[model samples]
Target: MDPLDSSISLGAASEAAAAKEDVESPDALLPWARFSAWLECVCVVTFDLELGQAIELVYPLDAKLTEKEKTSICYLAFPDSYSGCLGDTQFSFRLRHSVGRGNRGTWYEDGDLYNRDAPVPLQKEQSHLYGYVYFRQVKDGSVKRGYFQKSLVLVSRLPFPQLFRALLQVVAPEYFEKQEPCLEAVCNEIDQWPAPAPGQVLTLPVMGVVIQVRIPSSDDKPGDSPVTPSPKENLLPAPIILPSPHEQDLFQCFQSMLIHVQMLWELMLLGEPIVVMAPSPTMCSETVLALVSSISPLKYCCDFRPYFTIHDSEFKEYTTRTQAPPNVILGVTNPFFIKTFQFWPHIIRLGDVKMAGDLPKQVKVKKLAKLKSLDTKPGIYTAYKTFLHKDKMLIKRLLKGIQKKRPCEVQSALLRRHLLELTQSFIIPLERYLASLMPLQRSISPWKTPPQIRPFSQEEFISTLEHAGPQLTSVLKGDWLGLYRRFFRSHNFDGWYRLRLREMTHKVESLHLEVTCDADLLAWTIEKSEVEIVDLILKLREKLLRARKQQLGVGEQLLERLERSIHTVINSLPNDLQALLHRH
Candidate 1:
């Protein structure tokens, strides 16, 4: 079998088994029952004078990791900083490992092995785990270095940075005071917390802090909630609440480049390769995270590294100019990346956050030479032309808010909501067109093969855009249809189509099963001739075989019942006819 086919077969089998289990035990569908725990492992990384950064401790002791994995974690935990600044810093990075391996050389929590082959359908299977690190540097007289610097890293598949940071804030300090036992207590606490289920408001208590967050779902609407709630409402002794997992302030990070917000959104939606250069890891990582979340409800399908370094395994692959840059967003703090990623199409250089009353520098689109000459100045260097014209009204409103001395958080919320609505408007048309492609229930026939979804035609989809395309706002003026035409050629569109196709196929299969289960087998067999009854039996048997071969989640109990019904019908017939049928 082809490798891709093999993978699909395996995935279908897994889904089928899971569906069967879910049917057997309804509780299996619950969020808490599906996942193991929020926290995977607690890693303590310290800077050594001779060996550079090294892993001082990994809680649970037996948490499996390769040598290269350990090195990568240590480097990522500690920022690429030369100065001995004493404070706390929080950032995140992707922890990648091969898929085929058991739990032997990879990070595993609660004896559960990483079963997911890959997030995207790639040739090589790898697991991408998110690692949230909280680093602290404090003056210490005991150590000869005078400063005790270490990072307490939380490794998990969950991408809730704010929640993880809060947990670290409470746990890291206590860990420094009391070593191994503190991590043990924290792990126990995390294991007790409920799973991070999307579309639900979860109240998670870790150590002393209680975190309340709502994981965004694809089904969320733009107008569901206000951009920002009143301060009075938030002061009711509430836990650290975030509306979404990607809670980084967009207005604050891109304050200088607010005018080009529409252009940035376009780049993200198209899956363009962009690089973000910032002064600190915290800023770089947060900005990257914010960019990826710009089109909320629609997940960014491309690979993104929030905090990438020279030591990362993919360093050579990313930096090499032998081939075109892969569709990815890389965040880096090092000055060296400016020269290395010069060939990349889009680059956003950011300055340090300024104090109130300080004039915010406006972003200028500059050439590579100008960017190199004025290294300190923030700017966007890109040659990519945006499809849609700039939304000047949105920019004017944001600028007006700034002029009126509105809070930064409020301004950020405004931008976030605008982006969300913009994405929804763009997606709504495509969704409508795809919905039209699904085979209708009335078209299905019992004796016929299952109907396949209509093939997606670019021209057919585009024809409806004039009437159905984005109409949420009238602020922007340009060829909206043209923008969509270009979008159809993008990786984002491909990923979205594949996902929708799978979902539609599953729905069709479920409908087929429902129809089969509701069939009046005994009555139909009674009316039919012996040869016709035999043919019907053969058809049913063929469907069962096909379902098993396809690895569909067709319930075993349903199959058994269908089999019993066929036998009952056969036995109800004349004995000679039954014998003839059995012989055939």
Candidate 2:
């Protein structure tokens, strides 16, 4: 045989042995024979600027079993960072039998797993003790892509007998959600060509671009929020979580942010003008990426900086390792490449701040000062009152974006007042607003709710319950119920319920301690008798009124009940409140 053919055969044999663990001898390990194939090795993960890149392992993260069990339950798995963008990626596994372990049989009509035009149908049967079994790779290693790495892990999975379920659940699907976009971006490119006619050669999809940022000097500050390495993060800055099944409301903030971005983008498209004020290195970049991605496939002039300018390329080489950032920034070499940034028709950089090209005029430049005039944007003030996220710094920065366009002074004031109220809501991190509020979220969001009314601000009370929001969540959670219960059993105040219950107490006390022998109770007996049946009935009416005051929240039904209680209490009183024996 030719030396090269001999070498190829020998190399193939050795590779197969390594896979089967043949060094131990199959005869010594009966009932199991292994086969090995290197197959093709393509990147399990890839990236594009439109979607980023990666390889994903969509496994049964909740599965759990012993290592030995896993061996019998066989499966095929790849390491990944998938967020499970592929909704239907799971496949079935089976055991095939043969007359002889070494026998190779015809496996498929089209051939093995390499059939690109057909589904990879699987076959396995009960042992006849005379055949060779072959396993096929149904789905090959895929080039996954996404904004984050978790997508690979989310969509891909380990083999059957799923023992890795628990491992998968340790993380969340959100960790790999973006993998769909990234993977799709890469996969679509592999089998796709740009739009074209029957004979005209089509253009290829644009390859991904890289972007790097240079903050110049953005060392961590003393008290800045640290970005955890995990792909998913809890909203609470302190790491506290709500009771099971409860999630803090983020609708207000997120919705508001989305609306603002949508409007800003639309305005820019309409040539309405833009205002760039203090652009944060962190927020500005994140905003740009998300904003661009959301409105993808749209043409725009993107002016991004070169690699060397974003960071000190020489310093990065010296360190050999640069810190990873929270905001996304893919790099080519010297500067980080903004993958999405490539979609823009042009890019404006700090380097161009002094340039004389038609760039500034060609691209709509809205200044930050102009946006502040939008004081009346209803959406702006709405979020200040409702957002439940603890990332106040992010909010403040985002708020700055639309502050330039706000209008409506009184409305804005009311909105701020409402914000103060919600900021101090019982469920939120009230600690931040403690100095700013009292028992009640005394103030409102600056642009919504009522203005801060001095004198009565601290005394913002609707009886013993809420006279505020329609939800009245605060009163339901506070001590109002307990206080109302205490009110039902008045200490010395004459009330109907108290007088009625007094009979029960008297009977019990009497039954336990004979009335004649209870000498100290003589004065109490005289006072209790003073209620008299008719007056006790009238006191009952007053007691009923106070009962209504408890456990009230901010609603029309509650308000009506409170009014009736006040009326009943006033009618029961023999004189004005001034004449009452329990007057404070």
How do the predictions measure up, each by TM-score? Answer: 0.80, 0.16
Estimate, for each residue in 309-334, the C-alpha lDDT of model 2 and write its tens digit.
Answer: 12222223322323421111221121
Best by TM-score: 1
lDDT, candidate 2, at 513? 22
Measured over all alpha carbons after superposition, the RMSD of each candidate to the real structure, in angstroms, is 9.7, 28.4
Top-lDDT candidate index: 1
Which runs in model 1 stand beyond 4 Å of their true positions? 1-35, 82-85, 101-126, 217-219, 226-238, 354-359, 373-376, 471-475, 524-584
lDDT of 1 at 278: 87
Per-residue accuracy of model 1 over 309-353 as CA lDDT, tens digit each: 988888998889889998999989888887888889889998775
lDDT of each: 0.73, 0.26
Clash number for every model? 0, 113
Worst 10 residues of 1 by lDDT: 115-124
